[model samples]
Target: MLGRTPLDAPERQQEVFAAVLGVLAEVGYARFNMDLVAGRARASKASLYQRWPSKARLITDALKANLPELPQPDEGTFAEDVRQILLAWGEPTPFDTAGIFLGLLEGSRQDADLACLREEHVDRAYTEHLRVAVDRAKARGELPERLDADFLITALISTFVLRSEEQGVIEGIVDGLLRPLIGTFRAK
Candidate 1:
C-alpha cells in the first residue's frame, strides 16, 4: 500500500480496471500484484487496497465490470430465444476478454476467494439469466415442464465458455445441444 486515500473517480476506476485486465492477461493471477496495477494505472497501491481490499477482489470486480451484459430472454419461440441468446457469443465486442476469462477460470480452481468471487458475480448472474429464459420457455409450453433449467443453463454456458477456435463452433454446439431439449418440449 502506497497511498491511503481510496480511488473515488469513475475515470480512475476505469483506468485501474483496464490496467488490471491488461496486466492479468499478461502475467496471470499468480504473478498479478497491486503494485504493478497501481503503476500501470498511475494510481497508488494503497488506493487499490483501500478500494478493493485484496488482489482477488480487485481482479474479480474489474473482470465483472468489464463483462458485457447478457441478452434479455425473448418471449418468442424457444428456438428463436435460444438461438438469439447463444448466437450473441459469435458477435465480437471490444470487451472480449476471453483470455483473461480463461486465465481466471483456471486460477479459480486453486484460489478459493477468486472462485467465490466468480461464482457470486459472473457465474450466478449468467445462470440466473439463462434460468429465466428456460423457465419462460417452459411456462409458455415451448419447453418440457419438467426440464432442469439449471442443467440446461450450465450446459449452454459450459459449451460456449469452453469453446474451440473454429468460428460458429460454439453456436453449432449450443444449437445441437439445446434443440434436443426443445424437441422434448410439450406443445402449447
Candidate 2:
C-alpha cells in the first residue's frame, strides 16, 4: 500500500496493516484515502479492490486487525468473560474506532456487500461478544429466564456510545457504568 504491489503472505499483510494504521492515526477517517493507504502500504490499488471490494471493507478489516478479539466465553460465568472483553475494549482508545465503525455504518446504508460485511463482522461480532457474556450469566443462574439478550446487549452498548462524545472512554467509565446493569440483570 505504501507505493507498490502487495506481497502474498501473512507477514506482508501485517506490514500493510501497520502502514494503514499509521495512515489512520495520522489522517483520521475523514481525510483518509485509499490512494494514500496504498502509497503507505506500498500495495497496488488493484489488490485492495480485489481483496476488499470497498474502502469501508478495507478499513473495517484494518480496524478488526488492530483490535484483539473478545475471548470465547464458555467460562461458566458471563460476567467474567464480559468483564475481560469490556476491560480490554476499555483499554483502547474507543474514539480511535469511530471512523471505521462509522464508515461501515454508512456503507451498510448503501451496498449489500458493505452491509453484509458490517452485519457479519461488525454488528454480529460485537453482539456475539455480549451474547457470550449474557450466556455466562444465564449459565451462572444470574439472569432472568426471559431476559432479552439482544436488548440487553444493545442497551449496554448504547450507554457508552451515547455518552462517548461527552464522557470519553477513560478506562473504567464504560465498565463502571455497565457493571451496575450487569449486576441487576437477573432471570425473571
Name the top lDDT candidate.
Answer: 1
* Residue 92, candidate 2: alpha-carbon lDDT: 53
Worst 10 residues of 1 by lDDT: 1-10
User: Candidate 1's residue-wise lDDT over 1-188, tens digit each?
Assistant: 43333466676677788888888877777888898998998787776787888888998888787766678767476666766666665567454355676668777987999999988987776676677777788788777777777777777776676673467765586467656656655433
Per TM-score, the best of the predicted structures is 1
Tell me each candidate's TM-score: 0.77, 0.65
TM-score, structure 2 vs. true = 0.65
Task: Please report how far candidate 2 places residue 5 from its true position, in Å.
Answer: 6.5
lDDT of each: 0.73, 0.63
Candidate 2 per-residue lDDT, tens place, 58-131, comes to: 76676566666656655455555655655555555533454445544555666677577666666776778788
